[model samples]
Target: MIPRSISLAIILSILLQCARSSTLDDMTLMLSNMPEDGRLQFPELANKYGYKCDTYNVTTDDRYILTLYNIPGDTRRPVYLQHGFEDSADTFLLRTNTSLVAFLVEHGYDVWLGNMRGNKYSRAHESLLPDDLQFWEFSVHEAGTYDLPAMIDFVLKHTGQKQLQAIGHSEGTTVFFVMGAQRPEYNDKVKLVICLSPVAYLHHSSPPLFPLISLVGGPAASAALSVAAHGDLLKNSSVAVDLIKVACTQKLLSYEVCAEGVFFTAVGRDSEQFEPEFLPIAIGHYPCGSSVKTGAHFLQIAARKKFAQYDYGLAQNKLKYGSLEPPLYDLSKVKMKIALVVGKADTLTAPKDLQLLRKQLPDVVNYHVMDWEKWNHFDMVWGKYMYVFLFNHIHEMLTKYYV
Candidate 1:
């Protein structure tokens, strides 16, 4: 019943998603993968650990394909590891071979690391082409609802487990919180959740970073980016990957990572001024489509006093689906015991945030902290010394939690 042009457009959209991925071969083909010194390069680190990277399609018919890392081991429980923004599963793999994913896998847990949208592994479902400006506008909610839930369901189905253990870092933690708050059903599905640098409060952001974002993130700032975008004056845009190589170092990239990090990283450190440290990005902007329109929904929690989901997005012709505030899932109401890990030096998520989560929970069976003086926002996964600092703590916690 659809017109020929309409049917063709639909088929083309399907084809666009299929073509969007930066396949394994592309990683191998590029000489410019992250520099060996960068902590986020998995192709090199995977080789170091002899671990393999595998790609999976998020949709059955193919709107998105999630790149996941599966290091083989003998664990019965599956730990779903989600990476932070402008990052991918490689963050864990590259930082430590005996890392969380591999550690959980070895200690009787099947470890699966997931890549979210805009990162190297999760570039799909953008309604626009790679060069189109529409591709770059994703916020936290889309990552929580569509990207994360898809990966979790895939892990549950693949592992044949009704419930799985979850671990999230930084924005990774925020997205997970949004997922739990917005989709309370997932709460029942996850056995335990470990939030690293939990960020319900961005007040901890380094001072210099906050003012910069407030400067550009509002409507006036957006208009500037739009006007400049129209003038084709975008910076370092030749290859988004190459831009990654530059931006991560330029300090501007920190703004790209988190809206709040803009303020958080710029203040409060000696050797580290809140500058965007260099790291790898997958390709280009991930088109969040209707997801951006739903921003007012997720912003309510931050606007209100605590963790809550505002609502979900709407489809073109379909009736509205997710609009209610994610049911008030009192952490005190959580049936299974949980563990909370925090980085004391993490300016983004100070001790207070985890304490807030701990205060709300019915059970806080275990608490851990990465108190190293050098640790910062992204260091939990991407720090040069992350393996030295974090691996043992993770080993200790998982052994306690799983056993």
Candidate 2:
């Protein structure tokens, strides 16, 4: 006796209500069961997962104090792992048993994790506090020129190794490439360099936020964010972390929607591979912090579509580099045997940009694209299948190249 349209509408309403109620219940359960240990600092988390972690402070040439984490192994083969943008040494420790650090340690390879300056773990300076504006004046340029060299030297000296194999993910790869191009001497100190989701030529980047900023101009965006955050952006502030936790894990929004909107938009979209349980811990540690200048540099690269030094505008560029524009980092100068692992779905590092990078690098030992179509940018560090898809290849490379 009911009209068909009315009945259909009634059914749809019931289904919608059921879906919302189910989402709320799932969110509640996930929050209650969220692992507290994931929120711990790097060393503590590593220890919780049954791995012995050692912390060392290395001073950069520019006097920035960086924190380095080491997972000791019986062998003299030291492998350095550097994290990506707005991340810390904790990036490698997030996956617990299947983590890259754990895999390397289990294989009897010494692993050292590098935390770049301005991150939560490495914000100390000889004279300036993190609150000081001068302390925030650095970009990836300083990171590559100073942080990488300092950490590399410290690890080599501590292990008494002449050379080490280096693995870098995202911005980590950028810094390594910068070191190789600028301080070519350090290239000899590294036996092999493996780049994961490498980000050097970012003009083809597809991230909406990055490209928007690129359109507005890097300097303007940098200035705006710097002014708003007082030189530090998203550096694991309790307020920001709590808000993110609520947005991503709370019952107000479904976990899938929040994850897709917040994290997946920046990194690639791969819901199946992304561990929902790890979301709380990842939110607590990530967007760990970086200077406005560092972000501006990347935005500049994205806008210009060139792998070059920081752009200080015309006057400053003239004063600094004696030119009206920034100078390009000569990838041809990087003579070390380099291998690249890229995700086909990575939005931040496009295939066209990767081609540009490949065209420039002098010695590319290997170039690999993930077989899985959904493999993404963050998956380099957070993917659940990393051991099966990524680590095995790395192990083979170590066997082939590490001498």
Candidate 3:
């Protein structure tokens, strides 16, 4: 008889609080008991941190179904983060609160992470199967033309925001540059672009075995392998995949395996920056998946030292590009305000290479070099001290622009 309606509201609120608390407890248990080799997908990882994760399936114009993960936030400002070469959305979420996805969401910014074509999450197509060799017939060019635009449009539409902040790591930066140059209109849709460990000019740095491919083997080797394997790269049965799984899973072996397979593949190796506990977690999702053509394209960049279009042979280049030479991307079209998060020890995007790229861009708001001289290419994503050193600068810039 003492205000029945108010009493009902109080009871409902109490039940809701209890439910949230229970969910958090369950999540903590799940994390605490996680197996060494167990890898949680993006949705599960996001929920473990008391945040709601929403997955969006975006169909590119080229027919690939790309997955974008969103951490729902109340803020009107949205940020889209793209992963690097052979990487997936999970790469951005590997370090939990220290990861970019969590950092942005907790700071009142809506966050979205994208998985490019042939990656773990974005492997499906409208009519084609992942096993079909044709599914592996693309490079970053296709990603820039189809995947980025599709993801951007989808995120914008879902969030109902006219413009959003953008962050790209390594190949993410490469693809974004391509989109800005080729699909110039997309430039207007990005508020600020924070480029982490950018990769454009790679003449001085080549991944292991890359020099062999460019010199003696070249496209002939690629063609032979393509014919033999039906275009699938890093196939499940392949020796490379098996070695990666075995070597990287064991604690004792991860140092050599991960350092070589991941760290050395990009740039300098800093044992201090790597966290041994997360090596299995990192390797579980890395080299996510990509076409052999994409691998070949990075080789082309290293060989030519130019951010140019994919090179077909002279005859094919003429037929496809109307010229014997594959044209270099017009960097003049990259009109957005940009920031370069560079490091001193990153061989792939070395200071000289970055200087060449910096000359091409019209408007560079900030060219921030990392405080740690030993900070190398992959450190931006996997460093143990990221939240303390790397993320602080990133957060500062984001805040400056968010206002």
TM-score of 1: 0.66
| lDDT by candidate, in order shown | 0.53, 0.82, 0.76
Task: Name the candidate that leads on TM-score.
Answer: 2
Tell me each candidate's TM-score.
Answer: 0.66, 0.89, 0.86
* Runs with alpha carbons beyond 4 Å of true place in candidate 1: 1-44, 60-62, 96-98, 105-108, 126-137, 216-337, 384-389
What tens digits encode model 2's per-residue C-alpha lDDT throughout 241-360?
434444454443334545665567667788877866667667767778888788878888888877899887788789999998999999989988899999989998899989889988
Please provide, for model 3 over 28-51, each residue's C-alpha lDDT reduced to its tens digit, 9 standing for 90 to 100.
342342344336677887788677
Error of 1 at 164 (Å): 1.7
Compared with the true structure, model 2 gives a TM-score of 0.89
Better of 1 and 3 by lDDT: 3
Specify the poorest-scoring 10-residue window by lDDT in model 2.
1-10
Instruction: Decide which is better by TM-score, 1 or 3.
Output: 3
Off by over 4 Å in 2: 1-34, 251-254
Question: What lDDT score is found at residue 336 in candidate 3?
Answer: 78
